[model samples]
Target: MGPEAPRHAYFVPGRIEVLGKHTDYAGGRTMVAVAERGFCLAASPRQDRRIRVCDAACGDTVEFNLDPELVPRAGHWSNYPMTVARRVARNFPGIERGADIALASDLPPAAGMSSSSAMMVATWLALAEVNALEDRPEFRENIMDLTDLAGYLGTVENGQTFGSLVGDRGVGTFGGSEDHTAILNARPGHVSQYSYCPVRFERLLPVPSGYTFAIGSSGVAAEKTGSAMEKYNRASRLLSKITELWREATGCDDRYLAAALASGPEAVGRLTQIVQHARPGEMDPKALLTRLEHFLTENEQILPAAGDALARGDLARFGELVDRSQLASEQLLGNQVPETVYLALSARSAGAVAASAFGAGFGGSVWALIEAAAADAFLDKWIQAYREQFPEQARAAVFFTTAAGPAAFRVT
Candidate 1:
């Protein structure tokens, strides 16, 4: 790679979960909007089959030979870009040469804004360009669809292991495709509605005029691995466990939680009845009941009505749903900490139309829907309120207003 060689630049947007909280991995539905902040990458083709990746934000650099033997570097951020490069090499064997890639971003890492996914997408897209994969008939015929690409990346991030090979699962988060969808499919002025079980996009609901999306960081990092792994994995597994209980009790063994939810209130009522009357089981009955409550509230009401409210410009209703979603996150999901809860509540008090903590939630960022006209005042008051509580943390905390943005795309 040299300065004279042409470098292709790419932009991949970060995402904010607006309506759905901790529901994607349960094979449930969630609405997500693309944040204006995202990852940017510049790549120049190399003469050798070795990829060099530089993280501009943290000044970390990793260089790896594009080989089939690459395994995940557990607990390392560079593994993400490495995985992207490995996936490209594995899927497109003809791409012998790699690229010199440099990354930069305004998006804050560990804020539940999908900063990690943005980098992965950026690296993949850059490799796509550097290898000229689209020019190959096989590449154009198969790997060109944006949704499919997003799904593949999502699997790489959270998919389970397959024998000795570490298939797609990166870093061990076990998350679904919501973040990738928001990064790859979100359109400007619209939010994407879709389900994770079947991985289909329902529709794009428009963002109403005179409103803006505000994101407030909790000053606490939402680190998904190490200490948080058990809790995050437990939340996902509990959903499956309850669904299993429903199937066994009702003799309807072939149903997902989302499908049962679609069957309406009576269906859920039956499950609740069974749960309440059941004898002491291996799983904590109370904990199972709490999770069931969160799952039903989102799949039954908050998720379905959110699209309609946005379509009809009913932001107030949407705002109320956001608050409910947060409450569920706190009470049932147990993902919120004191810092995040206060930020959300304070933002609402400062006149945000709706406020809730979004993303993987063990203390990440919260989103607030505020009037476009009052955005500045809202930020000022929100910051003041947050800083008053923890002045030292205020330095690392980030606050900003964003709107829907287009998915990852080439930018010359």
Candidate 2:
């Protein structure tokens, strides 16, 4: 960590899930963008295989050996950086050096703007730079492009194997690549649309001119730990169960629910029948059906239509579609809390063009689209509205405006 040590620095932005909710893991589509705020990190290589990370803001530091058997401290912020180090070591062996990383962030922790994923990405980028992981045969063979890197990083967080690279313990979430994809690939001033389970790019639509997004953090931490982790993973597990049942009922080998539904024209009807006739103790038929409905309506319908609406400058239609997404998240995905629900409704009433609670959503934040000229007034009104309703949260809530920001990159 001295001036003479070779160093690399990076900035990894947080992300907003514009349209897709709990759909990424199911091989579904989502519109996402990067937030202006994120993590800033500087890393220098260590001669020995010992990784040490210091939180510049808090002065909290964690040091660990670059070993595959590294166990993360439960409920500690270091788990994110530790998981990234362990995964890198496991995936690309023969690494003789580690890194000394110091990081600072402006993004709120656990407000569902992907603070955790951003940290993970920053950690990986630092390690990759110091150890030249990208030039390694293992890394070159596995990660072909930014999209592939995003997908692989997602596996690092979810404990899923990416191609020939193996996976071990993740940070205890069964999420997908949406956050990682946006963090790595979002275009400034435009919303990027993508589909996961293989990470495909669909299109990019400009944010309607004269408008910006107003983000309101609900002050309820949506950390993917403890009970919240169970709830978040349950949504993912339900989708997996649906795919399993679909394959069982019909002899298809579709890997995801989206693929299962796309296998035939009668797929929906057949899946509905399978759910209805499912035996006791197999899975909750009602939850499975509701989850499927949300996925179909959100991914197959609302997301694409919303993108088209934005493309055509149809603000009214776009707002309506976002409303549907919010309702579905509340009723079907069952991720929304009262605070988030209130934020979405209140944002609309406060005259946002479109609004919805976004991210892993047991309790998180909401994004409201409004004219740039009205942003200041809109935030004031929106914050006032939230304050009147949830006074306790008003002190913890954060309100800010940002245009779609740049992706993660080297800080030069």
Top of the candidates by TM-score: 2
Candidate 1 yields a Cα-based lDDT of: 0.80
User: Weakest 10 consecutive residues, lDDT, candidate 1?
Assistant: 160-169
* Cα error, candidate 1, residue 402 (Å): 1.5
The estimated TM-scores of all candidates read 0.90, 0.99
Give the root-mean-square deviation of each candidate in angstroms.
3.0, 0.9
Tens digits of per-residue lDDT for model 2 on 1-412?
Answer: 9989878888899998899999999999999999899999999999999999999999999999898888888799989988998888899888878899999999877899999999999988988888888899888888899999999999999999999999888999999999999999999999999999999999999999899999999999998889999999999999999889888888889999888888889988989899878775756788888888999889989999999999998999999999999999999888999999999999999999899999999888999999899899999999998999999987899999999999998886
Top candidate (lDDT): 2
Q: Which residue runs does candidate 2 get wrong by more than 4 Å?
A: none
The clash numbers for all candidates, in the given order, read 1, 0
Please give the lDDT score at residue 275 for candidate 2: 82
In the range 62-154, model 1's lDDT, one tens digit per residue, is: 889887667758677877887777666666676787889988889777888988888887877887787787786655554456676666677
Error of 2 at 97 (Å): 1.1
